[model samples]
Target: MEIEVAIAGGHGKIGLLLGKLLVEQGHTVLGLIRNPDQEDDLHAIGVEPVLCDLEADDDVGEAVAGVDAVVFAAGAGAGSGVERKRTMDLGGAVKLIEAAREKGIGRYVIVSSMGAADPPAEGGDAFGEYLRAKAAADRALVESGLDYTIVRPGMLTDEPPTGRVEIGSRVERAEVPRADVAAVLAAVLVAPNTIGETFELISGETPIGDAVAAL
Candidate 1:
């Protein structure tokens, strides 16, 4: 089924890969980007670029209106401080959720971190703050009553996709390629069974499709 998908943080590594994959699959993809310079990048992959800053926008519903699904793939990025973690990671996700609800879009997917569910108590650094923010965002999505799937991937690498993964309610921490994470996110979008299912992702022997199907 061909559908329109709006991706927040569309210029991110995983988001760009996912957009290309979706476009190749005959789906219309809209990439919500904050930088005008990134428009051509999104267009190069056949994704329509919508300029909207997740942090500054009060109502993003207009940006996502008419899309069949929405994906929250934004982050505060590495080296970011605690405040950016709260505002961008958590706040950005909250904005997307509200926009999705306002537009009456049901399918919502978010890329989260592995330790979000149980962040370290002793660490008061940026990474710890990131986990807590993600946890809060996950909670909001779960309670939003939308058809949402939270994908918590392990340490992300830039390696090529393996096309195989291990997914479960909770899995051991390990490295998974950003390409493979994109593949898993694409699969989750099309799999109705994945709705309301939150799982940890990592490199495994199981094919991406089979792994998602088994979920």
Candidate 2:
């Protein structure tokens, strides 16, 4: 089943690969990017780019206008400060949820981090702050009355795609490749059983195909 899906921050590491995979799978992928210059890259990869700043946008409701599903994959990457972490991670997520609600779009997915359910103690580090923000956003989305899935992945690596994965209520202690993360997101997009369930995933030396099948 091909769906018109909008990927917020579709140019990031995991987000970019997910957009490519979705496009290859015959899904209409609209990438929401902050930089206009990023559109060319998306176009080259067959993703239609929609320019919007998640932090400052007041019209996200219109931006997502006709899409069937929404994937919130945007985040403040490493080395970012606390402000950016909150703005893009938590605040931006909440804003997008409101936009989805106003537009009447029900299917939503959030790319989150492991341990988000239990944030680290304050004054820890930037990554700690990020987890707390992601947790807040995940909780908010679950209560928003939208059909949503929150994917909490462990430390992300850049290894090539490994088809095998483990999916459960909590994946707190493992490292998963970004390619596998993208694959999981793509699978969830079409898997009816995964809807409304927050899942944690990690690669386990199995083929990506077999891993998805196991899910």
Candidate 3:
């Protein structure tokens, strides 16, 4: 149970929260961050930070080396344009899959969006394009031949973690806290039954443990 897990966007809202929980559960967490300055933030929570750029670097394999599982939480952000959306959201995920394959790491998890399964039919705006990019990335992971779980959460909020969630193959739009999403991601990472599954999450009655165990 002392496996090592790495989070590609380790400093991100969900990634950082998940890293803390993983460390507390007696797992070693390696957080891949673009800024070396963020090392202190991760170290403060007992996470080992590995500095690497997911979009523009060639060291993804090295960044994720020796980890038992990987969680890709990287994104280009709302202010970013179309190219960045593809380069970071889609391209970043593909690189991680390639690295996981190259390094012999089988377990992979992705922090995706609810609409990723089906991109918007007619729009090229940022949100529309973002969904398209995510859909592409999700497809890549499924075809990567790796043990993967794609957790798509609806409207992200900054509220506190509910420790409960509603999980299904596809769910309606609703808001869930970033903290809850992090907790669910952490749970999904170690749940063997969750492998090869893609689910959507939102606020609900089922506890995190039960939600994932029932996967």
- Judging by lDDT against the true structure, name the best candidate: 1
Residue-level lDDT tens digits of model 3 in 37-68: 89999999999999889888965899888899
lDDT per residue for candidate 2 within 104-188, as digits (tens), equals 9889999988888889868667888898899999999999999898999888999998677887777549999999899988988
List all candidate RMSDs to the true structure. Answer: 0.9, 1.6, 0.9
Off by over 4 Å in 2: 205-215
Residue 53, candidate 3: C-alpha displacement in angstroms:
0.4
lDDT for residue 36 in candidate 3, whole number 0-100 = 88
Tens-place lDDT digits, model 1, residues 24-143: 989999999999999999999999999999998898899999999999998989989999999999999999999999999999999999998898764679998899999999999999
TM-score of each: 0.98, 0.94, 0.97
Model 3 misplaced stretches (Cα beyond 4 Å) = none
Tell me how candidate 2 scores on lDDT. 0.87
Between candidates 1 and 3, the one scoring higher on lDDT is: 1
Candidate 3 positional error at 147, Å: 0.1
Model 2's TM-score against the true structure = 0.94
Displacement of the residue 201 alpha carbon in candidate 1, Å? 0.2
